[model samples]
Target: MSATAVILQNRFSNDGATILSVAVDGRMVHESWNHTVSTNDARAQMIDAFLDLWNVYCEQGLVLYVSSRTVRNLLKEQQELFDGLLIRDTITGAMFRKTWDVCSASHHKQRREKRPLPSEIEKEPTPLVVVATDASKGKNSKTVGLSAVNSCGIIKTHEMELNSIFDAELSAINFALQQFGKNVKRLEVLTDSRQAIQYIQGRTSLQST
Candidate 1:
């Protein structure tokens, strides 16, 4: 089986961005294209992007990143027409995991090959810090509690006032990042707020006044 992977990301309405990335040889070497779609209609933009990617990597395992559940449902409903392709809302899905693992291993191998022998100081590298953030709203009040917990058993909490739960969730993320981001090279943040994730990923946009 030929090891080929393709990733499609359609963000036309949010910022007119449409991206396609391809990798081969079980490596993360990517040949990517980014185009600014001229269309303003969200559904049309998504369909156009999907069709374009589908046409190019029809034989490869195509993975799509789209925020619209409607489009995902439509594609799911038509399984026979889009067989062999993986429709995903996030990069952590199975289709992306294999591609990502291949890329990561390739990069690490190249780095190891260039490094000197074991004559230098040998110490374990710092582990990646993973943080989970959450926010809870007070009953019949604007007060909110924001908490950030890390893998190291460290917990940080704050209480504040926010207009809505969405705001509180977003604020919690910002607070967590601010508290744990400094002087750290690698950090992973986990949150259960889908709306907050969508906002941070630029999949959902706020209306301008």
Candidate 2:
């Protein structure tokens, strides 16, 4: 596990990649590479590495800690692959500290200093800025809605109806990504349709009727 984590760290992008530490039984077993990659290819590779780490722990009957950033990225890029994966978001300083302590203890290392309060912790990690799109077919009309959110929740919702749900979902995702801008480091999209999720997963391409 240690070696696998080291390899993953090396493969991740250094500039933006979040550090991923893995441990079993309260012991630090692996720490991902320092590099950070934001491109799709990099995200795919990171997912692969994470799966490998997950399998290693599964074989040994141990639980692993995954960062919120990592979870969000995977949720966006490879939602299916992570469907049943045990993931916990370490967003609050207390949560982060607790997880960190678990990892440190796994390796027989002393726990590090705790971070500032949750309020003090930067809101940057939260997907405060988000766009959600949903589609439904009524007896005579189809409807689509676009909504925006910050830390407090939905700030705006727009209604429209495209020919298909795929169109609506894509438009919502695109709009959110655009609105959030490149400066935003994290974004979360919420949808209730499995078809939308599958479409994004590349299992099925969008088709217009």
Candidate 3:
């Protein structure tokens, strides 16, 4: 069992064409493409490299870290191919993508310091600027009411003509963000709408009927 991280980056040729490169543990393990590859092609290439690495190193178990959400989703779709693999997304993957070669030098430091990945670290306590949002719509009415209240006793409301309560709930969240997002570096948003939360978290998509 080992912790292996992979990063996919775009390299520009002398002629200014974008090409894909794959880095494994901050080292350039694959970059043989001479021609530019499409986004899907690049993702395929990265997955191929990952599988190749896994084949060679899958002794006990392997935990893979990757930054690309699309790549992770593709791997998840092919359950049989990655049946025993543990995949995780991390900010360190994106950081390594940006500084592929340079990050290699830091590997020793990371090992010496026993540094943990950013995602592995615990997040700080919640900030004081917490906000709650809600939306109301009358039955068979197109008019929607949106409201946002913060912990500081400030209330903001808006009235709009929208088609669905889902849209209104989302708008209320957006309205809350606009009201306080700029002023605070960290803000906690609370909403009772599970569908809205799912859409916001990218777990589901919103479709207009």
Candidate 4:
């Protein structure tokens, strides 16, 4: 089975940006650098970027290959998401171990034949982020949550409760996207509730505004 891996080069820190490279079969596929003001907040942005990359791989039917270190750090730092996803260090380590073994065997065999290493496989370009929001309302209160994700997983999340859940959910997404700024290549809005998704997609009109 073919696999795509994302290797995080730099550590998350306040001083420098995070760098990530996407590859398949030892070939570099996609690379990007993100400047972060706050390391803690930057994690959400980083996850969003990775999710975008994951969507692209999924489109091509490729399994993800993440470095053991990256997986370990992610588990430690983002325990909530890691636990929710049921990710463990051992699982991630095993994946990397398999990849290393394959690469090593290929390198040793090539040395015997005096042949150049096989060219790295290139991956499809990354996809755009998808935002999903949901809201619920009580007699006098509302609750809302919005998730930013791609094919791979959820990158960022925001939730709150207000008098009107629908309004809160929409507002939450709008505010969250503002942080990303403009020049967003593509976007897809989703909601678990049909009414909310349709309203956002413009299939249904918002009578009030």
Candidate 5:
């Protein structure tokens, strides 16, 4: 008999934090200060908000979208209110975790842009150079093999005395940076290590700032 459903999701973080907010139809309706309320207080607010919405739309269907298992169990305890309600994503933690997994499956590698030959240039500005670096660490190997290739077809490889992959990766990055002494303002270094990229970018930004 119910024609419309009020979609709801209770979003909160931590093991015992209060419900940060109740998203009704994708809009936050009732929100509590995070970690500032007791578990009892969280439940009370949830019940209050549900009852308020139910009073207005009880004739309509109720849909619950729960992303956390703890929050789902808490709501399940109120069987009287939860009866006849529709539920989606019953016991999943970390919303969008699966979606992000799918995203990475297809977006892991980026496409490289094509460049024109040096002879086809009319007025050449600053020479653009792109350096790609990578390291190989096989099992039972003590040394790391670091290699770098530039857009100008210049390739360099080094056997570093570093034992860990991180060390080898940093050495490869340094090799790329050392390719240009000065006057090369446009330099691009591509690597598979996200941690290295983040650290180098963060340090460079902090120094510039």
Candidate 6:
């Protein structure tokens, strides 16, 4: 019997965003197009991202085909992360696993070797310190993870407890900023929690003006 593998297609939306679809031997699968969950650009919320992938993975295995390297990388990361998690069909609430292929092509690795990466660019380190923060639920208490990298190549990581991921995002940002105190004159903070940003910027309804 021939192995059943899904065929995939990639295209650009009018807004220039990537739109991905899967097909079985030329027949399109619309069942999932309408079902892709709004992850709110989920990064800190791995569960939300995982559920989006699980929506389709429970069926025939997925084989993603993409034109843009960026889209390919995003899909690859999504697939790999979902691969790590023990998941269930969110709709059916049944545990399962499925195969995933990331932009597979014949002699693809060998082809990539032809174009070696250029030497590191010579430049002074950036003036701004960049920090990324995230939070997630833990067994006992909510957990927060903070990572920071400076122009000088210095890196640091921190962890702490919080009431919830929502709270963690806010607390993590403050913890990250205070890690170096007033020493960081120029800084850039990165976070996955939109609500946290809204609250901090005084744009959220929950926050009073």
- Candidate 3 lDDT over residue span 94-185, tens digit each: 54454455334443333334435677666664455899999999999999999999998899999999999999999999999998776466
| lDDT tens per residue, model 2, 1-209 | 22212212222224654444564443455654334546554556656656666566444432324444654455546544543444444323444455467554432321121223567555654434454545444556677666555445546556777776667666666666665545565667776667677877867766633
Candidate 5, residues 135-158: lDDT per residue as tens digits? 887778768898989887889888
Model 5 has a clash total of 0
Say which prediction, candidate 2 or candidate 4, comes out ahead on TM-score. Answer: 2
Instruction: Name the regions of candidate 2 deviating beyond 4 angstroms.
Output: 1-133
Local error of candidate 2 at residue 48 (angstroms): 64
Best of the candidates, lDDT: 3
Question: Can you give the lDDT of residue 199 in candidate 5?
Answer: 67
lDDT for 108 in candidate 6 is 32
Clashing pairs in 3: none
Model 5: per-residue Cα lDDT at residue 63: 60
Candidate 6 regions exceeding 4 Å error are 1-127, 151-153, 207-209
lDDT values of the candidates? Answer: 0.64, 0.50, 0.67, 0.51, 0.56, 0.46
- Reference-based TM-score of each model: 0.38, 0.32, 0.38, 0.30, 0.35, 0.33
Candidates by lDDT, descending order: 3, 1, 5, 4, 2, 6
Q: Which tens-of-lDDT digit does each residue in 77-149 have in candidate 6?
A: 6665544332222212111112123222312322234332355333444456777665556767556665654
Candidate 4 residue lDDT tens string, 8-78: 44433456555544445455555555566655555565466456655655445344434445554674575
Off by over 4 Å in 1: 1-127, 206-209
Q: Give the clashing residue pairs of candidate 4, or none.
A: 142-162
Model 2 worst lDDT run, 10 consecutive residues: 1-10
